[model samples]
Target chain A: MANKADTIISTLITRSRKPLLDEWLARQATMAGSGAIAADGDVKEYCTRFLAELDTGLAAGEVGDIRGAGWSGMRELLEEVSRSRAGKGFTPSETASFVFSLKAPLFALVQREAGDNAARLADELQSATTLLDTLGLYTVEVFQKAREEVIARQQEEMLELSTPVVRLWEGIVAVPLIGTLDSNRTQVVMENLLQEIVSAGAQIAIIDITGVPTVDTLVAQHLLKTVSAARLMGADCIISGIRPQIAQTIVHLGVDLSVTSKASMSGALELALKRIGKAVVERKARPAAEVS
Target chain B: MDQIPILMVGDCLLVSIQVDMHDQLALALQDSLMTKIVETGARGVMLDISSLQFVDSFIGRLLNNIASMARVLDAATVVVGMQPAVAITLVELGLTLSGIRTALNVDKGLALIRRIIDGEEQAFDRREG
Candidate 1:
C-alpha cells in the first residue's frame, strides 16, 4: 500500500527490450515448428508492441489484475491475437505460446536485475511469474472461446445446408436426410416437408432416409411425428430407403410404423404415382435396339 | 358477433374460414353448419381452414364434432386447405383428427366427397369399433 509504480518489472522491461524480443522470437520459432503458423510470422512486431503496452500497464501499478483499467491495451492485444490465430487454425498451445514464451526471457531479466539481493530476487521473480501466468492463462481462455464460436457457426451452416425439400414430381415431394437426426434437425425437416407439401400441392411425399446412418427409437418417433403432421395437412407420407439394418432395428424396437413404407425411393415414387392415378411406362423400343 | 359464411357449391357446402376462430365462433359454426346441412340435403362438406393461424384443443374437438354431425346427416366432410403450421400444431397437441377426411385443396376436396358420395371411394369409417 505504501509503494506505487516503484515496480522492478517496469525497470526490467524498459532496459532489456531488445534481449527480450530476441529470446522470445527464438523460442517461438521452435514452438511446434512449421505446423500451423509460419516461422517468419510478424511475431517480432507483436513482441515489440506488446512490450511497449505492457511497460505502460506495469508503470500504472495495477499488475495484480490484467483486466484492470491499466491493462486495456494489453487485453485488447491478446484478443486480437486470439481472433487471428483461431481463424488460421492454430491449436490451443500454439496460440497460448504467444504469451507463455515470454516467461523465460522475463525470468532471466529478473535473475539479472535482482543480482546478489536474494530477497529482492524472490520477490520480483514471484510477481513476474504470477503476472505472466495470469496473462498466459487468459490468452488460452480467449483462444478456446474463439474456437467454440467457430464450431457453433459451422454447425449452424451445416444444418442449413443439410435440410433441402425437393419436389420430385407435380404432386410428390422428397426429403433425403443425410446426417444424425436430432430433435432440432427433425423440427427443421418436419416444417420444411409440410411447407413443401402445401405449396406444391403434393398429395404424396417420399422421405428417403438412405443416407441416415442410424434409426433409433427417438429418430423413429420423430419420423412418425412428421408423418402425422403431413397427414393432418392431407398429404400422405411414404418412408423409403429402409435399409435392412434400419428395418430390423425398427421392428426390434417394436415401433409400429403403420404408415406405408417402401424399400427404395423408386418404389415409393411408384406407389405415389399409382395413388395419384399416374404410372410411368417404358417408351416403345427403337427398331435399331430391337435388332441388336 | 361475426359469422363464417358457408357457400353452397352444387351438392357440396364450402366453408372457407377466413377469420380467427374462438370458442364462441367454433360453436356458432357447428350450429349453423348443422342447420344448413339438414336444410340443403348436401351430400358433402369442405372446410377451407388455410387462413386459420391458431387453434387449441377445443377447436380441434369442434372439428371432430362437425365431421361427426355431418356424417349423421348423410354428408361426408372433407377438410381442405389446412395450413402446414396448423397441421403441425394439431399433431404436436396429440390430436390426429382421425374421424374426418382431409384433402389438399377445394378441387381435390370436392373430388373426394363426390367419390365417397357415389360409392366409388370408401369414406373414412369412424365408429365405436
Candidate 2:
C-alpha cells in the first residue's frame, strides 16, 4: 500500500510551503544568531531549495526509505549544504541543525492537520521524525568527509613545502632537512634534489640536517638513498649539521659515516668552494668605494 | 643499422648517445670506440648522456663496460648529464658506476678529464724526479 504518512505530509507541505518555510527559517535565524549562514539572504535560499527538493522526494510516497532513487535529489542537496557549511567552519551540531530545526514547524503542521485522529497523528509524526533524523546524520557524515579532504590536501602541500631544493651558488644546491625522514619524505627529497642538480647543473649539493630531531637506522637508510641518487646524478653531496650527539649515535650504531660530513653549514660551504677551485677571503680595511 | 658517432675533441673522444641503444648498437659503439681510442691515442673519453632520457639495467651495464674498456686502453672515462630519473633507477638497480668518474656537464667533464690526465702526468714526473 502507498504510504499514508507520506501522502499526508506531502499534501500539507504543498498546501503550506510558504508558512512552513517561514516558521523553519525563523527558528534557524534565532539559532544562527551571528553565524556565517544567516548574515545574508543565504539561509532563506537554502531552505527554499531544500523544501523544493523535499516536495519532489515525498511525491513518490516512499518517505520511510530515503535511499530509494526517488530521494537522490534530496540527498544530493543535503550533501552540498553539509560540505559547504563544513568548509565554512560550521560546527557539526550547527550544520546538522539546518535539517533538524525543520522538525518543530513540520510537527506542528502535522499535529494541526491530524486533529481528531490520534492514530493518524502518531503515524505521521513518527515518519517525519525518522526522515529528519536520517537527513541530519547524513549531513554530519558529508561534513566530516569534507573536513578530511581539506586536511589531506593541506598535508600534501606541507610535504612539498618541507623539501625545497635551494641553489646556494652557481653550481651548488642545498636541502635543509627538518623533522623525521621517512621513506616517502626521502623519495620527495631525492627527486627534488636530483631535479635541481640537473636544472641548476649543480656539481655540489649540501644536505643540512640541523633541524632533524633524531636519526634512526631507517632514517639513515633514507639519507643514504638520497645521497646515492645525488651521486648518480654526478653531483657531490656533503652532509652537514651533524651535532655531537648524532655523530656519537652514528658511530655507536655502526652506520657508515664514510660519506663526507661537516659539523656546520659554513664548513661544508667552505669545503665545497675549495672543491670548485674558489675561496672566500676577507679584504684589507681600506676598501670603501668612492664617487668623486 | 643506426650507429652512434664518436667525435674527437682536443685530446678527448666525445661520444654523445643520441638514440635509444640496442645490443648491437652498443656493442658496435664499444668496438669502434676501442679502435678510435687506439687510433687517436686520446687520453680521455667523455660520455654526454644529457639528451638521452631513459635507462635500464642494460644501458647501465653498457656504461660500465664502456668505462672499464676505455680504462684498459689507458683513457679516463667521465659520464656527464645523467638525468635525475635515470640516476635513481640506476641506484635502485644497485649499479653505482663506481669505477667511472662523473661531472655535471660536458664543460665540467672536460675539466675533470684534464685534471685526471694532468694529475697522472704530474705523478709520473714526480716519480721520475
Candidate 3:
C-alpha cells in the first residue's frame, strides 16, 4: 500500500501547486523581510522552481526520508538557493525561511484534506514537518560551509597583498610590513624577502615596521627570526621604523632584536648604502648665468 | 668517499662546498682544512657555500667547528656566498652561527681577509718601529 501521507501530499502539490506557491511567497516576504533585497519576480521564479522540484521528489518515493535517492532533485535545488543567497549576504534565518515557511501552507492543505480523521491528519502533519525540517537544516549546513570558504579565500589574498618585498637599491631590498604579524603571514614575508635577496644579490635588507600598529613579544620573536635568516644569507638586516612606542614595548617585553635599527626608512636606507660602499651626495648647484 | 677539495690561494686556504655534504664528508672536510691550515701556515680561510641549498644542524655545527679550529691554528675564517634559503633554514633550526664572519661573495671575502692581514702587519710594524 502507498504511504497515505505521501499520496495525499503528492496529490495536493500537483492540484494546488499555483495557490501553494503564491501563498508561500507572500508568507516568506513578510517573515524574511527580504522584499528590500530580493525582487518580487525573482522570488516568484524561485518559489515556482522549488515547488516543481518538490512535486517531482514527492512523486518519486517516500516523503519522510529526504536523504534517499528520491529527494535528490529537491536537495540539489535547495543547495543552489542556499549557496547563492549565502554569497548575496542573506542572513541564516532568511535563507532557511525559504524552506521553513513552506510548512504553514503545506500543513493547512493536509488539515483540509484529512478532515474529521485525527489519526490521518496527525500522520500527514508529522511526515510533512520531518521532510521540510531536514531540507531547512541542510540549507543552513551548505550555507555555513560556503561562507567559510569565502572567508578562507579572502584571508589568503590579504596575506599575499600585504607582504611585498621591494628593491630599494642595486644591492638593497626592503620589506615594509603593515598590520598584524601572524605565523602564516610571517612565512610569506620570510619567503618573499629571502627569494628577493637571492634574485637581486642584495647585501643589505631593511625591514620597516612603521605601519605595524603594535609590537608584542611574539612579534618581536618573528622579527628576530627573519633578521637571523637574512644574516645567514650573507646579508645584514637593518630594522627601521622603530617608533618610540614599539621600542618601549620591546624593552618592556625583554625581547632583544639583536639587529641594527633606525628611526625611519631614510635612516635605514642611508645605512644600507654606506654598508655597500655607496653614498648619496647632494648635487652641486650650477651658476644661473652659465645657461645664458 | 668523495673528499671536498681545499685549494691554497696566497697565504689563505679556500674551500668551496659544491656538492651535498653528508656528516662524514663534512668531518672529512674539517680534518683536511685543519691539516691544510697547519701545513701552509695560512693566515686566513674563506669557505664559499653558495652551492649548498640546505644545511641541517650537523652541517651548521661542522661550519662552527671549522671556524673555531681555524682560529686555534691562528687563521681567521670568513664564510662567503650563503644562499638566502639556506640561511633561513639555519636560523629556523636555531643555529645563530655567532662569532663567525661572513661576506656576500668570494671577492668581498678575499678583501676582508686581506684587510685583516694588512691590519695585523701594520700593528706588527708599529711595534718593531
Candidate 4:
C-alpha cells in the first residue's frame, strides 16, 4: 500500500512537468531582454512559435495545452520579461557604454528622418543630450557644449580685471570707462583703480563717466570706493560728467556726494595742473576760479 | 554746463560725464561706462561733472564703487570736472565717497596719470633695460 501511494504521487507530479518547463522558458527570455522584447515585432512571432511548441508538447503529453493559449499567453510572457529586467542593476561604466553605443542608432534615426525636420529634432535632442551629459552619460558633442560655456564665462570674467592702464601726466591718471557696468564689473573697476593708483604713485586720478549710460546705488558705491582709494594714496581723484537725467536720478535715490571732488573733464584737467603747483595763464580769461 | 564726454587719451580715460544736477543720468552713465571700461580695459577713469548743477549722494556713492572695482581689475579711477556749486551741494548732502580719486579737469587728470605712469615705466625700464 505504501508503494502504491508513492506511485500515485509520482504520477501527479509528472503530469505538471511539461507546463512547468514551458513557463520556465518564457521567464528566462524575459529575464534576458528586460522589456526590450516588446520593442520588436519579432517578439510576437517568437511567442507564436513558443505557443505552438507548448501545444505540441502538451498534446503529446509533453505540455500540449500551454501552446493553445496563443496571443494572451505571449502577452503575459512579455509583461513578465519587462518586470524582471526592470529590477536589474547597471554599473556606471556599463550605463555609459550603453548610452555611448546609442549614439550610432540615434544618429541613424535622425539621418533617416532628418529630411524636413532636422532643426526641430536637433533642438529637441539638445536638452535631452545635456541631461544625459550631466548624468555622466555624456556624448562627445554634448560635452563640447558644456566646455564652451565654461570657457565663455571665464573670458568674460578675465575682461573685468587686468585692463591695461595708460598714464597721461605727472600726478594724474585717467581711466576712460566704456561699455556697461554691472555689479560684478563695478567691483573689478574698484580693484583695478586702487592698485594702479598705489603702484603708479599717482597724486591725482581722473575718472571720466561720459560714456556711462546710467548710475545706480551699486555703481555709485563703486565710484566712492575709487575716490577713497585715491585719497589713501595721497591722490586727489576727479569724477566728471554729469548728465542731466543722471543728476535727477541721484536726487531721487536720496544719496549724497559731499566728499567726492568732481569736475567736468576740463575742470579736472585744470585741477590736476593746479595740484602740481601749476596754473594755466589764459590769454584773455578772468580769474582761475571764474571759468564757469 | 553740458553732459561731459568720457574720452580715452593715451592711458588716461577722459570721462566728461554730464551729471545732471537733478537727474539720474549718472547711474546710466555708470552702466555704459563700466561696460566700456571692461571692454576697452582702460588704465584710468576721468570723470567730468561740470554739467551737473548739483552733486548728490547717489552719484558720490557710485563714484566710490567704480573706484574700488577698478582697483581690483588693475585699473585706476579718477573723477574730473567738479563744479563749485555741485561740490557744495555734495558736501551739504553729506555724501562722502571713500576711495574715489579726484582731479580738477581732464587735463589735470591726464597729466597726473601720465606722470605717475611715466615714473613707473621709467623705473621698469631701468630694471628691464
Candidate 5:
C-alpha cells in the first residue's frame, strides 16, 4: 500500500525535478524579511541537491522512517546542509525554510500529476507533506545540535582565556580572575594557578579579583578553597583588588577569607616581594636636568 | 607486614609515602613516627605525599593526628609535595589540614623546617641573653 504511494511521489519528483528546483528557489528569493543573506548560487545548489536526494529517498520506499537504511543518504545530506548553514550564521528557521519552501512547488506537481482524481491527489499530498515535514524538522534538530556544540566550545575557550596566570616576579605569580566563579571555572582556575606555582617554583601567588563584579558566600568559599590549595602547595596566596563594596559583602557574609589580602595588585606585589625578602627599588632618577 | 620507612635527616624526620596506604598501615605509621620522634629527639617531621593520588577522611584524620602528636612532642610537622588533585580532593572532603604546615616539595619543606628551628633557636638565645 505504502509502496504504491512512494512510487507515485518518486515519479512526480523525478519527472519535474528542474521545475521543482526553480519554483523553490523563486519562492525563497521572494520570501520577504527572512534576512538569510545567503548567496543565490548557494541557495540554488542546496535546493537542487535536496530535490535530487528526495527523488532517491522516495524511490527507496522508506519515506516514513528517516532512520531506515534507505533514507541514510538523504539524512546525511540534510545533516551536511544543516551544519554548514549553522556555521554560515543562518538562523534555525531560515535553515529549516530551505527544506520547507519545496512544499509549494511539490504540491503543485502532485496536483498536476493527480489530475481530476480527488483520492489520488489527497494521497500524494499527504505523503509529500509528511516526508517534507520530517526532513524539515530533521534539519532543525541538526541545526540546534550544531549550535550547542559551537556554544560549548566557545564557553571552554572563554573559561581558559579568563583565567590567565602571569609570573609577576622570580618567585611570584598572579591570577587575575575576571568572571563569576562557578565550580567548573573554579576547577580551571585552581588547576592553572597550581600548575603555574609548580613550574615557576613560586613562593607567593597574588589572586586579583578586581574584575569580579560581586562576592556572595559561594564566591568567598571558592576563593578560600583556592587560597587553601595554594597554601597546601607551599605558596602563600594574597588576594588583591578587594574593593570597598566587596569588603563589606565579605564581612556581612561573615566568611573568613583568613588569608592576607590587599587593596590592589601592586600592594600585593609589594607584600609578596617583602615576604620573599626582595625589594623593588626605583633607581634614583639621575638629576633630570643633567641630560637636558 | 610492610612498613613505611621514616628516615631522619638532620633535625627532621622525613617519611615518604610511596604506596597506597591502608588504615592499619597509616596507624602503624603514626605509631612508628611518634616512637622515632621521641627516640631521635627530631625537631621537625616532613611527610612527602607527592605519590599519594587519593586521600580519604581516614588518612586525613591520621595526618591531623600526626601533626598534633608532633606538636605535643615540641616538633613541627610539614606535609610536602601534595598533588593538585589530592589537594582538591582534600578540600572537597573538608580536610583543610589546619594546624599542619605544607610545602610544595621536599627542598622547600626542609627550608621551612630549618627556618622554624632557627627562629626557635634565636628566641631561646634572646631569653638567655
Candidate 6:
C-alpha cells in the first residue's frame, strides 16, 4: 500500500496542476530512493502525508502557486521531522545520510531557480553549513532561500570591508587599527589604507595597530602591501604600535619591515606633524602650503 | 574583597572586578554579566579587571562564552583595566578569552565603548551638545 502510495504521490506531484504539488512531488522523488526510503512503505506514507497536508493548504488558500510553495513546504515538513523528539534521536550518521540524500535535489532545485548564480549558491551552502556548525545545529538539507540569504550577507560584508574610511588631521591622516589582525581582516586593512592615503591628499598616513593583538606573517605581508601602496601614492606610511609578540613574529617570519616607517603611534604623529611642517599647537602660524 | 559589582552605562555593562578571582567566581559573574547585557540591549561591554591577579582556563572559557553571546546579541565587549602583568601572564599561559571584551582602564574603555556604540556621529554630537 505504501509503495503504491509513494508512486501515486510522486506521479501526482510531478503532474499536479498546482505548482506547489508538482514541486513537492519532485522533492519527494529525490528522497524516496531505494535505500534512503528504508522501506517502500515509509516512502509511500511520507508522500501521502505530504499530499494530504498540501491539499489542506490549497483548500484553505493558505498557499498560492503550488510549484514554489510545494518545494518550500516539503523543506518545512523535513524541518519539522528533524525538530521532533523522534528526529532528534537519529544517529549522527543517519542524520547526515538523510541530509546528504537531498543534496542533489536541492542543487537541482536551486540551479533551476537561481540560473546563473547556482555556483555562488553552492559556496553559500557550504558557508551556511559552517555557520550552522558554529551554532551546533546539524541539518541534511538547508532551504535554497536560506543559502541565498547567507551568500547575500557575505557579499554585503565584503563591500563594507572594502569601503575605506578617511580621517583627516591637519594635512595628515591617521587610520586607527582595531581588533585582532587575522589574514582576512589584514586584506581589508591593506585596501582601506592605500585608498585612503591617495584620496586624502596627505603627505603622511599613519596605520596605528595599537589595538591589534599579535601579528603573524599574513598580517606582516598585508602591512608590507600597504607600505608599498603608500610609497606609490607619493605618501609615507607609518606602522604604529608594534607589540613585542608581533615583533617576535616578524623576526620569526623573516619578513623585513625596512621600507615601512615603524613607530609607536605618537612617533608616527610626530613625524606626520613634522612633514606638514606644523606642530599641533602652531596650526595658526603656518601657511596652508607649509602645512600641506 | 567584596564580590564584583556589575554596572550598566549606556549600552555597555562595566563590571568592577577583584584581584585573584577564582574560576568559579569569574564564571558565575560572566553568566550574570552576559544575561544583563542581553537584557539591557547594550552595544558594548567593559570588564574592569584591575583587581584580578590570575585567570584560569575556566575563566578564559567563560570570557569566550560571554564574547560569543555578546556577538549574538549584537554587542561589542571589552575587558578593561587588566594589569599589564596579568595580561602578560594570560598570553604566556595561553589563557585567552574567546569572545569577551577587554579594556586597559575604565576611562579609556568607556571611550572605546562610546566609539563602538555611537559611531563618530554620536561621539561628535555628544562632544558638541
| Model 1 accuracy (lDDT, Cα) | 0.85
The sequence of per-residue lDDT tens digits that candidate 5 reaches over residues B49-127 is: 9899887889888889999999899899999988877787788788888778888899999999989888989999999
A77-128: candidate 1 lDDT, tens digit per residue: 8888888887777777887788888888788887877789988788777887
Point out the higher-scoring one by lDDT: 1 or 6.
1
Instruction: Give the TM-score, chain B only, in order for the candidates.
Output: 0.89, 0.96, 0.92, 0.74, 0.94, 0.75
lDDT of 1 by residue, B12-114 (tens): 8999888877788889999999999999999899998878886578978988999998999989999888888888788889898988889889888998888
Give TM per candidate: 0.70, 0.80, 0.69, 0.36, 0.79, 0.36
lDDT of 3 at A1: 27
Cα deviation at A287, candidate 1, in Å, is 7.2
Q: Which regions of candidate 5 fall more than 4 Å away from where they truly are?
A: A1-7, A10-73, A177-191, A210-213, A281-292, B1-13, B18-43, B72-75, B125-129
lDDT score, candidate 3, position B53: 81
What tens digits encode model 4's per-residue C-alpha lDDT throughout A1-292? 1112122222322454344334434543455333443343344444344344333332343121222343344334433333232323323343233223323333444344445676745653453244224323222233344445667878777766434455767656777676666777766666666556655666677887777789888777667655654553346678777667767777787767644445477777887888778887868868978986
Candidate 6 lDDT over residue span A117-197, tens digit each = 756556544532432232123333433334455677797697556444557585477777777767766666666665555
Runs with alpha carbons beyond 4 Å of true place in candidate 1: A1-6, A10-77, A108-117, A149-166, A175-192, A209-214, A241-252, A282-292, B1-59, B69-90, B104-129
Overall lDDT per candidate, in order of appearance = 0.85, 0.86, 0.85, 0.55, 0.86, 0.57
Model 2 regions more than 4 Å off: A1-6, A10-16, A32-34, A55-76, A112-127, A157-166, A178-191, A285-292, B1-46, B49-54, B73-75, B89-93, B120-129
Could you tell me the lDDT of residue A117 within candidate 6? 72
The top-ranked prediction according to DockQ is 1
Candidate ranking under DockQ, highest first, comes to: 1, 2, 5, 3, 4, 6
Name the 10 consecutive residues with the lowest summed lDDT in model 4 chain A.
Answer: A1-10
DockQ per model, Cα: 0.67, 0.64, 0.50, 0.03, 0.54, 0.01
Interface RMSD of the predictions, in order shown? 0.8, 1.0, 1.4, 9.5, 1.0, 15.1
Query: How good is the docking of model 5, as DockQ?
Result: 0.54
Candidate 5's residue-wise lDDT over A1-292, tens digit each? Answer: 2555345668877777777777887888877545563453477667777777777777677767788777887889889889988998888888888888888877887788879999878877787788889999999999999999999999999988988999999999999988677778877898899889988989899999888888888778888988888877678899999989989999999997798999999999999999999998888778879858
The better-scoring model by DockQ among 2 and 4 is: 2
